[model samples]
Target: MEKMKPTLTVIMPAYNELKNLRGAFISATGALKIAGISDYEIIIITNTKRDGSHDGTPYVAEQIVKEDSRVRHIHNNSYVGLGFKFRQGIGDARKSFITWVPGDNENIEESVAGIFRHIGEADMITSYTSNTQVRKWKRRFVSRCFTEFCNLLFGLRLKYYNGICIYPTKLLQKVPTKSDNFAYMAEIIIYLVKSGVRYKEVPMEIKPTAISSSFKLKSVFEALGTIALLFWNIHFKRTRIKIGSIN
Candidate 1:
């Protein structure tokens, strides 16, 4: 007998997380085992050094995959944004379902498995924090402000825009995105909702990681611009299509 194909693909992108990759890989594998789902694959993407120079992360990821048959690695020669790495993983995935487990291990292990349970009921599954407060004051303040601003501007009611999301890979492959920064995640969600795809939300625990990716002021303006473009495209183009009733 031969092994069956995987039902899910886990995309874990590691930039310079060689030290954390081992733990992240193990935690992901453990969650898969606890979920009782054997048919899945993990893609560890080590794009490049943050400064676009050579680094050890890619080599470390290569070694990890060599040790575990379930794991695999991709090392892009150039440094791309986090969203770009995700797009690469999405293109490389071979499973029906896909979810991102950030290299920093922000998602709790138990909650990782629970995401699979929601796939049966929705096309896209996202998460929010269970606790009332975020531990880091700056992160909490920025997160709240971003979510509120986006919801108000886009006419959505989502609690957290940058949290974990589990997507039907097929649908994701078909949708087009215009963002290459952190806003890429938001672009996908907004498209899904406006396009009438069924989505669900759940509460999950977010653990603090050893590293914090800088939230730059320039990225903020870029995201805001992406949102404006999406708003115009969705509302303006959608109204025209409805009037024409072009299926």
Candidate 2:
């Protein structure tokens, strides 16, 4: 039994994902239908290569967009940060609920189904990988550290922040930061939770993507810097002046 109650706008960030696009699209749509979501639009951000390589992504995006009215393409000829590309889609979203679905098949369609089921119950619905055994030891260690760090700092018992999430459009409009990197989503969650916004955690299984994870060392450092900046700005520097002056 499926009901068309809540609408959703799925923002998919695409790079050179020509190989994984078809399966990803199929799985997403199928899961949405299974979850009883009625009205939804999938926005594909077709980002070009920085070196002007022939990846056929824009052409693929064009073809896919033309075939399905529910699927739209945001073509970008130049390179940009993942956050900016996501923001481009986010800015163009036209639904009550919003979520970013990766173009690669790194996630299973079943996860999207879970989010849709719990979306209307809270302002934010987040998904974390229930089975960490599928990941490599190094990756698993890093993920655990990051999750613990977020919880300790924000006083939230959230398991993960880098995975799938569904957010209310109104709360996002009130969010303050617009980071253009891996730390952007974490900052979004932190900002909203600190403001007393409600959220729900949905555990789901993780799937391997067509391509292996390649987060560079530089990006990791940058993400850490963002975490520090956000922690200080929100908790210390910003909180100190709120409870009268400390002269």
Candidate 3:
């Protein structure tokens, strides 16, 4: 296969981010432009199923793309969950590097540039903020627990594996993405640990937002459950491979 242009393909998955979608793309694309990285593409995957129209995201994306060819928008007719959408976008990406920027716009331009630069040297680059300006206390606590659990289980202490992450496309190919929701983020981290890929962390400032739906107790539990499911998948699949060898 011909090598993809040395570009960064950013996948931003949205459920119903009609209000914040445009600004997110503008900021992201502008950041790359400021950094002089014109050879990049922003693939926005909008999952608007229950909304009055499925074309909301597509419309916004089209307007952005019209303004700049570097910006492209694709709509997911059927909501296949977060992990599935991320896989589809990254899978379709023709680039050397991949990043998943949240639709909420937490990852700003400077931070995006910083993270991408970090990924230039490392297989994976993660970021975190000691004071997440927009998140709730419960969400923060759960995030800390998840990070600690990952450290204990994988021996890698990454600051914020759950937020904006940039990695080489090769590493993503090596790791499987199975979560339907935000668990996809954690699953990626776990897979990286198992595959023994090189990784690094960077500090970032959390931009303020009044968005209340970003966090919920149920979502936290769902995230934890996703981690458990990943462990089960890994253990059972590994054992089956061993058994097949024996047979």
The top-ranked prediction according to lDDT is 2
List the global CA lDDT of all models: 0.76, 0.77, 0.70
Please identify model 3 stretches exceeding 4 Å from their true place.
1-6, 50-55, 211-214, 234-247
Candidate 3 vs. true structure, TM-score:
0.83
Worst 10 residues of 2 by lDDT: 238-247
Off by over 4 Å in 2: 1-4, 210-214, 237-247
Candidate 1 global CA lDDT score: 0.76
lDDT of 1 by residue, 1-247 (tens): 8644337889998877767777788888877877777888999987766567754778878888889898888888887777888898899998888888878766677877776666646768888777535347766776688889878877889988887788877778766775777788888888877777767998887676532563577777887888888788888866221111111
**Which is the better candidate, 1 or 2, if ranked by lDDT?**
2
Shift of residue 222 alpha carbon in model 3, Å: 3.0
Error of 3 at 220 (Å): 3.1
Residue 110 accuracy (lDDT) in model 2? 77
Residues 1-247 of candidate 2: C-alpha lDDT, one tens digit per residue = 8644778899888778888776678878888988988799999887767786747877777788888899998887787667777778778888988888887766778777877789777768888888888877777777788889989987888889887888877656556666767777888888777766678888888775322433556667777887888898888866321111111
Q: How many backbone clashes does candidate 2 have?
A: 0
User: Per-prediction TM-score, please?
Assistant: 0.88, 0.89, 0.83
> Residue 127 of candidate 2: its Cα lDDT?
84
Q: RMSD per prediction, one decimal?
A: 4.4, 5.2, 5.3
